[model samples]
Each structure stands twice: as C-alpha cells, then as structure tokens.
Target chain A: MHNRNAWAIAPLMALSLAACSGEADKSADGAPPAPTNQTLAEVIADKGEMDTLEGVIRNAGLSDVLAGKGPYTVFAPADAALGAAGSDLSDEAMKAQGAALLRAHIVPGALTRADILAALERGGTGGVQMRTMADGLLTFSRDGDAVTVTAADGATARLTGDETVAANGVVQPVDGLLVKAE
Target chain B: MKRLIPLTSVLVLALCASSPALAQNGNGNGHGKGHGAGNPVQQDRDDDGDDDRREGRRNGNGRENRAERDVPRNHRSAEVRVREIVGDPPREGERAVRELRRGLERGESVVGREVIGPRRDEVRALLQGCPPGLAKKDNGCLPPGQARKIDRSQSYDRYNYLWRSFGGDGGYQYRDGYLYRTAPDGGLLGYLPVLGGILSTGNVWPTQYTYQQPPQYYSRYYGLNDRYQYRYSDGVLYGVDPKTQAIAQVAALLTGQQIDVGQRMPAGYDVYNIPYDYRDQYVDSADRHYRYSDGYVYQVDPTTRLVQAVIQLLT
Candidate 1:
C-alpha cells in the first residue's frame, strides 16, 4: 500500500498470524497467518521491551537495514518510551542526531496494527501520514483499537505492542519518542 | 517582477488540451516555469522533419506529451517561480500552484474510473503476479520473453533508463546551483534541489523527459522544505503542500498500479536508477536503488536518486 511499497509479506501479518493462530491460520482473504521467518531485524533483536530501541537500531547503522529486504514499518522506541522521554540517550544522542534519532523510528513500509487501522479507515484523516526514513513526518491516528503516532511537533506516540510479526516487516511498539531532545 | 504571465482568458484556458488518452495527442502545455518568455508549446499532429522530439521519441505523428514536454514556453506563474526561484511572495507561489492544480485534478479524476463492485474485487486482488496489463505501459519489466511485445527499445518518457547517449549509467553535477545525482560508481548522489544550471544537455535537461532516476524511497528534497512547492513530471519529483494542495509524492518513475500508503503515484513512466545489478534481487541495502516496474521493485534514493521505497516484486 505504499507504506512506501510493502510485500516482504505484511497483510497485517496475515491478521497477526491469524490472531496468533487461535483463528486457525485465517486466510481465504480473511488475511492473517504467516509470520516469523524472523527479520524485522530479528524481531527487534528479540525484544526485551526493545532494549533501548535495540541499542538505537544497532547504533543507527540500521543493523544491515532491518535485516534486509525493506519490509519495514518499525515505529519501535519503547524502552519505557526511551526511559520516559528523558531521551537524551547520552552524548547528545550520540550526535548526527543519533542517526536522525533512529530515522525517527523507522517507517518505510510493512506497517501493521491492521495497516494503521486500514489507514485510519481509508484516510478520513488526523493521522496516517508516515514518511520517516529520517526525512521524518509521522502521523498515524486511530485510538480505540490502539494506534497513536503524531509528531511534526504535536509529539504523540501511544501504540503498545502485540504487533511484532516479521518475515520482512512490521513492529509497532511505541509509547512516545515521536521526538524532542535536540 | 510583473506580468510574469497572466494575460488571461484563464491562460487562454491553456490551449484547450484534452487526453482521456490521446485524441490526436492534444497540445496542453502551460504549467509554466518559463525561460525564453513562455507559452508556445503545441507540438502534436507532427510533421516529423527529423526534429527528434526531445528523445522520448515518437517524433512524427505529433505525440510530444509530458504535458507538452513540461511547458517550457514562456508561461510564468507560481508568482513567477516564487519571484524567480525563492525571492518568494508571488502570492505564495500563486496560491500554491493553484492548490496543486486542484489536488492533481482531483486525483486525476479517480484514475481511469470503472471500479465495479467490491472495490473492483479489491483492485483485482492487487494485480496479483502480473497480467491484466503486465508492465502496464512500459516503465519497465517486460521480458517474460517480451510478454506480447511493446518495448520501445528501452522505453523513455515513462522511463526505461540508460542513455547518456547510451553510455548512460550516471552523470550530472552542477552543484551549489543544484543538480547533483551521480552514483554508478562515480559517487556524488544527492543535489538536484533545482534552480537550473545544466543548460546544455542541449534541450530537454537530460536530453528530454528529464533524464530519469527516482525510487530511493522518496522523501526530503522538497527544496529541503521551506514550506514546499517544487514540481516536475516524467523525470519524477513533486512535493506541493502549499496550504494542503496535498500532493507530497516527490518522485515516482513507475507504476502498474496498486501503491497505497498515502496513495498518488501513477502518472505514467519516468523513474530510473535501473543498473546496480539491475534488480539485484530487489535490494538488500546500500540505502536504496531498485527500479524494476509493473511487477514492482522501486526503492531508489541512494541519496536522492528519488522514490523513497515501493515493493511488490510480482506477488
């Protein structure tokens, strides 16, 4: 859907691998089943609540770019939202705005949370913008079923978890790091 | 500083052009950026005469479209290119290129309407692994033994790439005035913020259809954001947010359809960077550069080659 152009596999990870398979691998266009060949940079380096956003995406070298094949959608950030936004991550965020602050929390493609709630229900708007590979932008929106995002200075963030699903991309995890340190 | 072109009849309604898809090609022109005092473009209906028609070819029977090879005629107005490229205040680039031409003419009137129930079967299940217009209109991908043939000897306007007179892999520097994009081993990479300088590829920038190269997951370079306005076609590049005229795409280059995130992309052809091992298994990293087409590959931007990212890889 141009989350920049997905398809390393992300139909919301076949509805999150069919709600983690309780739905018996839901497919037949119910979408949702296959995930876990691992590599959204190895499920965010096997998340421990994403150890400081996985050491700032491997010190922002981008860990061979999320383990290759651009599946992307990331958003990450939850080390208690970078230690509750004290977010300096030391050394002036390790300069180069710390890899543009981890490329704003990566977005390129592979989005999920049901593709940001079907892109905020087919874009009525308030959120769904995206952008990121460091050019920044962010927006998202949808809330009840969970999703939040924001930025471009409104600085929001919400999204919680239950959406890692890999093979190529989809991460979600947030709480706040939409940005604001320097 | 004045009439920067508005001798109006709504710009003589910019010569009554129309192209539901070529009715004798229809002239059109007038988006205007002007160089030698604009408004003369009317090329289709060709007498041929070996003029080479800027190199996207199809010279003879009058087929010069890229909206009249990007209206090079002295037309002027974005309050005269923001009072000549950024002195600014031309009623804010004429109310942001007239609301990005009414939101890209209302998203190009729903791009070939004919939806048919259930969202046309979910846009035909997202055009599955090809067919139903395979490679769409030659922006790339055809060689499944030439899938019913239509190659254009490496296509053009909708871009197929490889031409610095065929040695074409990369070149163009100009710097500071901004034109940049070098990379094919030569390096340089991002620059083209645009204001002009390569005045002699001789005629159409990179010899017409603007040289082609856009896919690096496109974003940034809206002239490094000063509220955004930059526009161009075929050779990609677009940003326009001037009070929500909303288009942001910034470069597209190719599409057989089915791109979603913010949507847009699909103006037909013009996208590049098709070499680095040609599709090198759809990319692993070097930041960006992938091109393919129709069955989808795209990615681009190895430092602003342009596109930002897009993937479908035929399934």
Candidate 2:
C-alpha cells in the first residue's frame, strides 16, 4: 500500500539512480573526457540560432532541470524553422503547452549521431522509434546521409546541423521543431 | 467350511492386485524411456530445445521426474499450498488468495501473486478467533451479511474519510485507495474490487502528485535499447537514451487501465506492441514477444498468451 512515507521515498530513489557521479568533465587525476566541455543547458544557451527555443525552455520552468546533471538530448528547433512553423513562442498562458511542445523534441538519456546511426542499422526499414518525454513517439529514419525524425501524427523534421555534444548530453539542431500535429 | 474362502488365499489375491499398480508406475517410466531412446524423430525434436521439464507429466514422467517420488509428504504444489491456507471467510476473498497461486505458471511474473503471500498468514491468524457466523471480508472481521460491498464509490469514500487510522476502525487502514493492514489487523485478504488493487502513488502526497510533474531523470530501470536511464515519477514509464540523454515515456502507460501481472490482459485491453526500435529491457524472447499495457511491459508467450515477467518499472 502506498502511504505518505512511500511518496516521500521517490526522490531518494532518483538520488540513488543518478549513476553518473563526480564531475562530467575530466579533473586533475585524469578521468575520461566529458561528453562536451559544458553542460547541456549551457550548450543550448550558447547556440546563436537557439534563442527562441532557449526562451521557451526558460518559460517552461525547465531551465534548471535540463541544465542540472541531466543526460538529455534536445532535438532543438532553429529560429527560422520555428518561424516557418508559426509556433507561438510569445504566448504568456501557453507555458504548460510550451513545456509539452518542448518535450516532443526531447528524449531521455544521451543519444549521439553514432548512436542514432547504430539504431538505424539495427532496426532497418522499420527505422528507430523513440518514445518522447511528452508521452508520444518519434520515429527516426535515414534520408540519404541526413537523418529525419517523424512524429506519430506524421509531421517530419530533418536533422540539419552538426550535433553539439554537451557535457551532459547532445543538442541536435533540427530543420523543423519536432511538434506532433493534432 | 467348503463354501468359505481361506484367509491365506485372500491375502495372496490382495498381493497379486497390488503388484499390477507398481507395474503400471514402472510402465509409465518405461514409456518415457522408450520415446527418448527408440524414437529418433521425437529425440531430435527434444534436442531442438523443447521444454521437456515443463511437459514432464504429459510426457509420462521422464527419468528426471524424481521429485514426485522423493518429495516429503510436507511438500505441496502452489495450488495445494494456497488451499492449505485457511481463510475461508469473506466468501470469495479467501478463494481469491488461492486463485492467485492457481493462476500463475512457474515461468510467469509473480509480482501480483506475491501481493497475497504475506497476507495469507495474516488472514489465517485472524480467522483463528473469528466469531461463529462472522467471517473475514473487506479485510475486516465480519460475516457474509455484514461484509462491505466493494464499489468505486466506497473505495473513494473510504480513502477520503478523516476518521481513518493505522490500527483503528476494523484493523485496516485506507491508503492511496488500497486497504493496508493496521496495527491490530483483521479479515480475509485480497486485491481491490476491480483488480490490480490501486495505482502506486507518486513520491509525495497523492493530491500534490500529478503526471504533469516534470520527469525525474534516473540512471536506472527500464530503457529503450542501450538507453537505461529511467523516468517513472510521473506514473508514466519512460526510458532515457544513453547517447542523446533524451527520455521517452512509454505512452501506453499514460492512459490504459492498470492490470496486475500473472493475470492475462484481456484481448480488449489496449495492448501496445513494443516497437522494434527500443532494445528489449527485461528480455529478448525469440520464441515470444513483449507487450506494453498500463504502466508495465510484459514478456508474453504467443502460444499460451501467458504473461511472463512484468518488466520491473519501480525502485
């Protein structure tokens, strides 16, 4: 039976499961090099074209979560692409909606270009289907040398730029925002 | 004296009858050997990794079936073991405790089955001092006439009642809409009225908890492919990709009605096919496949539709 104590114990479980210990980067003792020189949130903020997306993340109250020791991959949207899609980035009341939209582009754990390619090779024609944090699925398939991500509602986006391997994760610049169509 | 049969002759006849029974047992053993040694076709099939141990009784008790004879009288199968637990009140509640054991196969997940094990002895103890007419029901010491009729309304009302206690109000406490044993304890024990008892609560006050709560990132439990970082706090099960670090929630757990493992999820249950893209977490069943229902993934055998391991999603 779930009681008050059981509920209180959940975060402690998370604390235990945070297996990545110490600093993400190398130290004086010469540990393995970090995935990237900076954390994921810092990497996102440093990106010149990801200003709108960065604003959205901040508005969603997720700046700390994404920045904190997260191993999350953000298939972040380009400014021009966000504009082309006509996404409402300025809406004040759509904070929750903004968070949901952001989650559609994100996945848990660190997925690099090599990982995606390996997944494609393993899955073949059916492609690699990844569950999004927003409770939807994104199917990844190869288009020539470029990779494309398709949503459950059939909306598609292509990975446009070199993946920014961050300290905690990767920030992939996509040509289009990975929003699921209604 | 001429009409009466002699005592010595009767004894001899009884001995002759008993010999055939032993021979019958021996013949059953012989048949198993004959199939293994003589039949090349059957031997080849067994070599293909047929579960001979599983089909032992049906295969006429092979040479390895020594437990049936060598076992002590105290050794009982799960069925008999459950039946031996005497909690005959609350009418169907006691029967349900036994049914849990009967429903499970050796290979299947026992997460749901295990829910009843600890309570079996507790119920047995409660029945020891039960009143003549009154029996254990609704986890209380009551008769069939006084048994609490379970319904969604009652379950809700019981959870909301402010007068509830850990050891008061019939030796049971209501928590997270499930019945938990109080300090005193009472009655026949079983799952909730609908099934699967109640949904596991989030890591805070149930009221304060909601799926909308931001996902908690973890480096353990359920994953898609090599991605093992898990997110289960929102009551939705998600796997974090090892490379990208993006978490994907298995969407089916968000909406499907929860059902316990060991019980066959009815055909009507919304069964989501675990996509080929995500690597198998609990198993890679070449002979069978995995399915996602409610909040858990299950390795289900296609031939028997028996749900195997319920993928562990919690700490």
Candidate 3:
C-alpha cells in the first residue's frame, strides 16, 4: 500500500475500521472468548506503561482518530520517556510540536514485529526507511529479533516489549521517543 | 654600478616573487629599513662610489622602475599562493591574481574551490569572525553572504549534504578538516580535536558520528599522531586535519537535526533560547515551571535539574 500519503486516506481509514470490527466479531467458533474488543487507547491504558503516551495522544487530539478505527502500528514510548522529555510535552508550547512528534510514531497500517523484520530482511544493508504518519522518515533496522528504529531527528528507539493487539490497532512499546526533525 | 643596476633589479624582482615573507619586509621598495635593510644590492651600491653612473641608470630604468613600484608588495605572490594552496598546477601567477581580483571586484566568489588565496592566516581569522582591516572593504573580501554561500558550496562539495544555511536555526558543516557552524559569516567555527570532539556541557549529549575506515590507511597517513581522517559513510571527501595530523581534529558529523520545540526532544537536542512571544506559550504545570532571567526564558524541570529550554525573550 502507498502509505506515504496516509493523511489523504480518510475513506480507507473508515473502510479499514469496518473491516476490523468484522474480523473481531467472527472469532473462530468459541476461540478464547473472542478476546476483549479494546481500542489502542484502551489497550495502552490497560497496559499501565503508556500513561504519558495516552496523555500525549489526548493532548495532541489524536485520541479520537486512534480510537475511531483502522490498524495503526504505534511505536509508543512509555511514561519514562515522556518524563525524560520534561516540560516540553507537559508545557504549553507542545500543542503543535508534540502533535507532530506523536504523529511520527504512528504508522497508518498495522506493522507487526514479524512484518518489521521481514521489511528489514528485504532491505539487507542497514534497514528500510518507512514513512510515518507525520510525513517524516523512520528507518528500521533489525539484528536478529532485536529491532531498532531511528527517527528523522536521529532519536533511536528499540522495541522493548511484545506487541499488544487492540481492536483498532497494535501498540509496540519502545524505549525512547520517536522525534521528527524540524 | 650603472651596468649592474639591471642585474640587481632582476635579482630583486625574483626574490620578491618567490618569497612572500621577504616581500612583506619592504625588500627593494626603498622603505628599506629593518629586515629589508640587509639587501645585498643596496649594500653593494653603498660599497662602490658611482653617483654619475647610478643617476644615468635610474633615468634609463625609470619606466621599468615605475612599473615595478606600481605592483603592490604584499600581493605579488598572491597568485602563486592561491595555486599552491589549492594544489592547482603551475600557471602565470599574474593571471591567477588577476582572476582573484576580477572575482572580488565583481563580488563573485573566487573559483579555486573556496581556497580563495594563500593568505591562510588572514582568511582563517576572517572566517573565525575576526575580520582583519583589509577584509572590511568590498574590494578586499567578499560581501558577507556571498562568502558564506561559497563556504557552504565547499561544505556541500565535501560532505555531499546541504548543511543548514547561515542564520536559520544554525547547523554544522565540516570543511577543510574543521567542524564548522553556520554562524559569524566566514569564520572558522570549531576545530574538532581527534579525541572525544566537543564535550557536552549541558543536559543534552552532542550527537556525534564517527566514520569507519581502514585501520591500515589511518596508521599510514596519520603515522605521527592518533588522528585519522573521518568522513560520513556517504561523504565525497574524507576529512584529514586541516591544521595537521598531529593533535587531530575530532571525527564527528553534526546531523544538525536537533529539535528545538515541544516535549520529548531527542537525546541530543535541548531547547535553545525561546523568544518572549513564546514565553506566554509555555504554561507552567504542577511538575515544571518557567523561569525568566536576563531577557531569556528558561524551562526548568526540577526533577532533572536540567534547563529544558532556553527561550530568548524577543522584544
């Protein structure tokens, strides 16, 4: 999919959302109670590590978008990363800059850890450069199962936890902030 | 003495053309005091009593003498210096000087790949923000922005990246082995010592990229010192210390990607000088507060004890 123009894919987003709900409802004949249909926001809130991420998404006004539907692959940074950012996000100026940076972490379509690895494998040199929802660049490199991502601002974040599947999207916890270059 | 005047003049011209240091001493220019006082021609003429012959020779050589006198002493070898510094093949020094003169006169950058002249110290000082008296004139030096443009051109040629231009948020460009900043137009920004590079003084760690190269070449080229040429993996030119291999300039590339706004700045970036217009933009939370000092606003996160941002209070 040409995800580079993700912002223009509003119709696709709605379609993907409907498709997701259909998949959730058709759980294979009583398979593990069909799993709770939680959105990415609910999954993050439930996980307890993404309090800052949850706050940022809310502040950036992307909570509704993330909750609405469609599969997004969010390399979400945990609370510690947010705290380390200090006043930048907690302060007022973050209204615009924070939104852009947050968008850089969220990809339009769900990218599983396996999918990331496969992309890296296909791009054998250092890694594959992916387009973020913020219209920025994210380079992904893999050494075995250890996946590391570099943002346009040169901030590197490594996948630290297993993926969390939500009704709307997937959340992969990262160790650092995914900052976009200004 | 009259017969010997032509031979003496040729010798004097040769010496002035070859040695820049000697030309500066007022060699044959009759300002013959101090270092220039030791010229053998003057001493020989003093030794022989030939006043009548000397007067005749002076009248005959007057046109040649006038032509020689018209040439500026310090600028005689400027052409040779330019060619030698850029490693260009030998050419007419006069033509090279004329080329430099024409470019400067037209406010165009001299096209010797930014090695404008042999006046390394003067040029280095000018680039370091110390504009010498001579550089203040348009005839002597390039207009401020054009010099920077030329320097940026050289920087692009070397690194294969358009480093941030002068005055916009400011970024680093490696040129002639020194890690330079786009500031103080036409000045040497910073010398990278072959060691740890510039130390991070604030909360942010300076982003550094060290080029990986063959160890054998490093040892061979930089035999006397620990310094090795560093270049970005994709850079066109590898950087050896412009100053010298000994006490090498540091090996690092400034990605110039430091984010100055918002929370969660990358590890290497910290807010720099927020403007007064932006002061009201930052709302103090329970955990953090903004502090105003010396016409600058600073965001202090008490827990980290780091100034999150340095905001300039724009009037």
On TM-score, the candidate that comes out on top is 2
**DockQ, every prediction:** 0.02, 0.02, 0.01
Model 1, clash count? 36
DockQ value for model 1: 0.02
Error of 3 at B136 (Å): 32
lDDT (tens digit, per residue) of candidate 1 on A16-131: 77666655533455333356777887887787777766665554344655675555567787677777332433222232233445555665445556545654665565555755
Predicted complex 2: DockQ: 0.02
Q: Could you give the CAPRI-style class of model 2? A: incorrect
Best candidate, lDDT-wise? 2
Residue B204 miss distance in model 3 (angstroms): 38
Lowest summed lDDT across 10 adjacent residues in model 3 chain B is found at B21-30
Q: Please tell me the interface RMSD, in Å, for model 1.
A: 18.1
How does model 1 fare in lDDT? 0.38
Off by over 4 Å in 3: A1-36, A180-182, B1-315
Q: What TM-score is obtained for chain B in each of the predicted models?
A: 0.18, 0.23, 0.17
Q: Model 3's lDDT to the true fold? A: 0.39
For residues B196-288, what per-residue lDDT tens digits would candidate 2 score against the true structure?
122221111121111121112112222223334332322243343435544432321232123333456434211223322222332234444
Evaluating just chain A, the predictions reach TM-scores of 0.31, 0.76, 0.73
